[model samples]
Target: MRIIKNLLSACCLILVMNSCVKSINDDLSFVDAASAPDKLSVMFDITQDNTGLVTITPNGEGAVLYDVYYGDATTTPVSLTAGMKTTHVYAEGLYNVKVVGHAVNGKKTELIQKLTVSFRAPENLVVTWAIDAVNNFKVNLSATALYETAFKVFWGDVPNEPGQPFLEGQNVNHVYASVGAYTLRVVAYSGGAATTTYTTTVNIVDPVLIPITFESATVNYAFTNFGGATATKIPNPQINGINTSANVGRMVKNGPEVWAGALLTVGGNIDFSANKVFRMKVFSPRVGARVLLKVENLTNGGIFFEKEVTSTVANAWEDMAFDFRNINTGNTYSKVVIICDLGTTGDGSANFTWLFDDIRLTNQMPVGFLTLPVTFDMANVNYEVTDFGGTVSVPATDPTNGANNVKMTTKTGGAQTWAGSTIGAGFTSPIAFTATRTQMSIRVYSPAAGLRVRLKVEDRTNNARSVETEAMTQAANTWETLVFDFATPSNGTASMNLAWTYDMASVFFDFGNNGTGSVFYWDDVTFLTTNVIPNYLTLPLDFQSTTYPYPFVNFGGATATVVNNPNPSGINTSTKVGRIVKGAPEVWAGSFIDLVNPINFTVLRTFKVKVHSPRVGAKLLLKVENTTNPGQFFEKEVTTTVANAWEELTFDYSTIPFGFYSRVVLIFDLGTAGDGTANFTYYFDDISLN
Candidate 1:
């Protein structure tokens, strides 16, 4: 009875296990094969009078193989895998194409498509160029070909770019900013994929000089005529003992609208660093004629400056100066514009004619404040805010030790931790980073005290020479002069050279502060001239202060700085640490420290540096070189122990030959080129020897 009860319980457990268990082969096992091919598309790919090529594709489900039957020549059909394509030459007639998809279960579904192979290549393709009516620099394209549906034009300015297309025989226009040589290519395409190409070199000679003196009769300096005014060259007449030139420009204004003028352009960018004054020789038809002189960026006409000057001489030539000292020097100006008789219309008579010559820039200033020190006292002060999030910097007159000051208002963009305002000023010449003076001071007036203000100096041409320092505003709404010292080099950064570094000064107000609508005022931006402080040279070389002179002589495009230690280790419990980033493609991107006193290797033979690396077994090299002699150096390589962890790497100098080694070199991943990423950054601290 006991054995029978045990057998019944075992049978019940087996039944339950059979119902709950599943097999791995259940997903692969299927009952039915998939359906046939659908959504098939075909287009003729013909060139040179129908070579008889067609591109066909199909969208299908579960099709592994297809048999295509071309009902033209042969009885045997061609087989293709699902992604494979085939082209066949055919005669000029209708041919039927039958496509059959084969399933995994040997099931087949058939579909038929018709093709008419009638194609002709584009012939007699021609392209012409002309100037646009509205804008002179605009180039208009006219392409034509037989049996062509569209065209592609290659302007040849942008590299590795495909041509832009337009309908065949349709006029297309492209505008060029400056005058130069460009190879223009045009492709005339047939209704299919057949195309014919034509190329021509276009010499864009938009002749118009800044000082438009019509002395030569070679090329008609095509001055853009506007407002019913015709500008041309004429022989200067000795009318009333005035106008003493061989040839002069004449603007004959017709009896239409007022403000008739002629425009000219320069070949290159105008340098405005020296002076902003403009001078011109004008022979007006009458006195008090309002002559307007304007200069604009050749690329963007919107960025411009204009001034109206009244002529004092009537029917005679006199020199006039237009003060443009307030124009922004940083913006490029290459287009020169002029207008005579500003308010009234012209009648094509002698009273309407205006003659001008010798439009040039001069080194003269108006009666006002200069540009140095940037006191914001000048009426033409220039200031613009580069947004960390979004901001606007305006001139404020609520005096806090100045006639006018800069007011910064914050704006929110989405959600950002740090929203700040950066306004910069350009110097006429580069600010030299001298040995004695490498600091700049600024007076700030903030709403609240202790707001962080960062000041960055850089070469406007190259941002790589940029270096920055920050200071906290001490008082609210009170002028406090704060100095930012940049003399102390950190990490492995190359020293700032007076030869090429730091020309422009940019200031950020309330840096790293959260986004809010707070307003701040700043004024009295100046570069300080003070006595230099000597570097405290010691063996330990701790990165404790901003004034600590780093011994790196070369950085090789790598950025380095001192920050809080990411990984603290033995003998490096200090808060400050040195970080070096390999930010260039060169494998030799490294730093070499130049010690004030050479290391005596006979006394101390081993050196150690605490390094926190991204991975284990990374190659880190420490080398010592003679300060006077390069290429004569000793180097040692070591592999890191743990990943993302700090370890001490001891470089043995005992095996090295005896020499006065003052400069120390470091290279991470010495043989591999760094792609300038965050992963290439390395942190180190406590470089000491025993």
Candidate 2:
């Protein structure tokens, strides 16, 4: 009786403590009451009729109703009550049908089912195909027939197979993505009553419409005379070797016409999606003759992209390149207009006659220092920011090298001294560093010159292995390409090696300088070599490399970045360190690193890291998991003994079961939730096995 009474009293005390803690927080009441639905299922069966009628049945517990969607011509969803069947007609083809179940508690679940329907051939079909004169290879289709309830088209392009179906009198348009021969087919149906199939051939080839090498058979290339300028296809009239082509476009600009030029209307729109740069041969009347090439849409002549270039050589054929990278691919352009000496009228003399040939389009960037090893910002490669005091954005304003530039704005009240950013910690590809190519070049636009620019490189995971260099500009207020030799820093330290795989890179506009709220522009970061040292557990990991994602897999919204060591001491004394900001809503926000080989437990049983926390007595947990079996894990926790200082914590794993441990995990304040604030932030360096 006494034991039972004591147990009841203990339970009451626990309940009172829980009640007090709960009363302190009320924000969590909606966490569980409103959640997304899960485990929804949808089953469907189509009728054998060529008419795409589909009967859909949705199944899910706790769901009040179902939203059925037939991924076809239909845009609206079919709302179905619980336990009721819904039907949707889909033509004879494959479809990705979706069912979203709505639960009573404001939750939802979804499932997608691939539905295939193959019916007997449709009937009473009338199929017709016409190529779009505006968009090359884009065909306009028409299908009409008596007793036809639906129509289907197999455009014969591999991607448009067993194709989509539509109703009669509907105009179906399809754009062929590539150049090739295609067999266009159509099927008509009478709503599962009868069906018929029709087929035809379509030839799609790249436009040979440009360069007016009239050598080929006489094809009407409508090079019409405009602005009193006339151009005609003729045999090479010049006796010079430059006129090697059998035929060329000869143009004569008559006087009194300042915009005297010729216009060639293309049968299809000029595609500038992939290739934007254009090159054309021009046999000019003289050097410095201004030649402007412009393209405008057939209907919307206002939507156009044009470039003007001067003839470099006199009385000789030369290739003039025009940059049209700013054009939008969504617009159509079919008319090509050329203007000679755009400003001054030309005389109908021998000097006004010119011949040209071999015009083409390409997407290559100009050859220069930027494109040599690697074109910075090429293909829009992502550069992840580790730290930023204010905001960073990519704007296409004034690029020194390519089509874009990166702008960095320093916050007014942000960190003054070392408020910097780093990118590519876990860089997938490492740039190779050689003796001759040990320098990195960058184009910068600073608010003022003479400000020190710092460049740093490190192993994304180790701080002890780092190199930094700084350069001050002699001129400011203008664009300048600065070459940084990776040999010394402002601290008078030299750490450069040809064999080092220095991948992570960071750039600072002003080293150790306070903020003046400045905006900076930089582009074209050129490097010859680049992270991570695998195996050899004896090697301590010091997060020094500027290349990043940092060599760690972070989870639970934890943030980790390599920065200047806040506290470097003991055997892990290094200039760089790993800073971790524990996230909220999770008691265990942490990260893990995968080693190349399994840890030799018998030889090295102690896991060590020099951790610096903001507060003492914070719980820090270190864990190891079997490489092959993540569930097979071992963990140890230690409390921080010192605050705002570095202390080495050694975890003894000698008693752990023998296993291939290849992953190491770290968690700060293991059981206590974090707000991702300054108080929950921590730093660690020299993660090694003892």
Give the per-residue lDDT of model 2 (tens digit) for 406-489: 544453345466666565343555556664455677677777755667778777667567777666554555777666655323
The sequence of per-residue lDDT tens digits that candidate 1 reaches over residues 51-149 is 455655543566555677887886877766667777777755688888777654445677787887765767998788876655656889888788677
**At residue 395, what lDDT does model 2 achieve?**
33
Return the lDDT, model 2, position 553. 81
Error of 2 at 449 (Å): 28
The TM-score of candidate 1 is 0.29
Top candidate on lDDT is 2
Worst lDDT run of 10 residues, candidate 2, spans 530-539
